[model samples]
Target: MYPFEITTPLTIDAAVQALQNEEAQPLAGGQTLIPTLKARLAMPEVLVSLTGIKELQSIAERDGQLCVGAGVTHANLAKQTAQYPALAALAVDIGDPAVRNRGTIGGSLANNDPAACYPAAALASAATIVTNARAIAADDYFLGMFETALDEGEIITEVRFPIPQAAYYAKFTQPASRFALVGVFVARFADAVRVAVTGASEEGVFRWLDAETALSQAFSAQALDGLTVPTEGMMDDIHGTPDYRAHLIAVLTKRAVIAAG
Candidate 1:
């Protein structure tokens, strides 16, 4: 890893100033950034650590919404019962305790690794990604595999989630890493339903439109019967075949529907 100057920014304005300069990166919990640096995938001239900014480390319940600061870590989420139980469940399914302790929501969404859990939660809850400049809806924030709408040097400030009526997350995890091989987050809105799928798509994350439509009509496990998941663009590595993953999507969606119900 290259040696870099580290600057601990005490305010968002200070952080933004550092980030707006060339080859400067904001350091959050360091779970992902540290590894990327060690792997030489990322080499920044300056690191503006956000941890010391107390405003970025808080979680608040306001106006019927749960607004979590971008710096909030998985370990903190796992231990908090005040969060929607479904989101907490999803947090528990992240990496091991050590990873959880260091992984931050902003870092996760900024990285947007295909198998990451935050994208699922953000999509399912229709959360807003608050950036230093503006707030982008989750659907608009995630552009593609490891891509986001955020501009260079723009740092995420917070993520705002409207409290759902009811929601649940179920993931078919890869044993060794505990990353989702296929994870489903099911949410119950007052009038409509939203189902977001992560982990089994070559396009990264997607909405199970059929399952979502089925649940909209009749929210039950049987509602998923006869649904055929398209096998196109799914991963086909040694982990599983495309057809195997397609089949799992249907089955897991049903189980999640039932469990969520």
Candidate 2:
């Protein structure tokens, strides 16, 4: 790691002010950022730790939604999955026990990793991202690979997921990294269905609208029998090809629907 000043701010205001420095970056679980520093991939002059901000570490119910603080670690979320089984299952399998202990939901979403699990759930559940500036709908939050709609020095306070009638998550992890080679999250409501796929697209996580429409009419694995996932813009890498990922998306979506039922 390069030389950098570490600032532990106790309040959101303090954290935001610290991030105003052009070279300062917010540090959460340090899962991705720390490694980047070690590899000299990133060299921010200041690391503003968000852990000390009390208001950013809460998990509670608010107005018919489950509000999860950005500072909540994956391990912490795993234990609470009984309330949100689909999300819990995804959290339990994130980067193993050690990584889970350190990775934060807010950090994961902010980083917007192409293969990250949280983005799938957030988008599938139609979750709301509450940031320091304003709330952003999940559909508008994720821009592209490792990108988001957050402005400079903006802080994500929490994420709010509305309770759904039924939901499930299915992930095909790359053996080495345990990151999703392709992950699907299916959230079904009384009137609408949402199917979000991650780790498959070149454009990052995106909703599979055709699958959603099919499932909305008949919520079952068989409902997707004739559906063909388009591969035009999917990621092609050493781990998987666009065709392979397109196949995985269908398989995982079916599995998730069956599991959700």
Candidate 3:
């Protein structure tokens, strides 16, 4: 890693101010950043660590939503199996124990890897992203692969996920990276059904609207029997083809719907 100054800020205000330096970067759990630094992919002049900021590490239920702090670790989230079982279940499958122990939700969302799991959860659950500047809806937050609506020097403070009547996340992950090659998250509400697909699209994580419409009308795996997603926009990597990923989208959606039930 290149030589850089590491600052541990006690408050969000201080962290933002520290990031005002054009060459400074915010360090969350460092799961992804640290490796990039070692490879010389990123060489920031300074690193502002959010670990010391007390307000950014918490989990609570408020006004019928689960408010998760940006700094909350995956391991911590996995333990809350009673309140949000679907999210907790997904958390346990994210990376190995060591990575889960250090990876933060904010870090994962901000990085916005095309195959990452949390974006699907956030979008499917209709979660709101809370940042230092403003709150952004999940629909508007994710722009594309490795892209988001976050501004420079802005920091995510919390994420608020509305409790759903039923929800499930199913992922077909790459064995080595444990990143989803094709993943689906299904959420059922009283009025609507939300379905989000990740690790397949070229533009990144997106909702499967047709399946949502079908499932909303009749909540069952049979509802999606003939539904198909176009393969033109999906990723075609060494591990899977676009056709295969598209097929998995339908397969996983059905599995998720059945699992949700």
What's the best-to-worst order under TM-score?
A: 3, 2, 1
RMSD of each: 1.3, 0.9, 0.8
Tens digit per residue, CA lDDT, model 3, 110-229: 989999999999999999999998999999999999999999889999999998999999999899999999999999988999999999998889999999999999999999999999
Which has the greatest lDDT?
3
Pairs of residues at least 3 apart in sequence or in different chains that clash in candidate 2: none
Instruction: Assess each prediction's global lDDT (C-alpha) against the native.
Output: 0.85, 0.93, 0.94
Model 2 lDDT tens row, 125-165: 99999998899999999999999999989989999998789
Total clashing pairs in model 2: 0
- Displacement of residue 20 (Cα, Å) in model 2 is 1.0
Q: Please provide, for model 1 over 148-190, each residue's C-alpha lDDT reduced to its tens digit, 9 standing for 90 to 100.
A: 9999999999999887888888888988768888888888788
Q: For every model shown, what is its TM-score relative to the native structure? A: 0.96, 0.98, 0.98
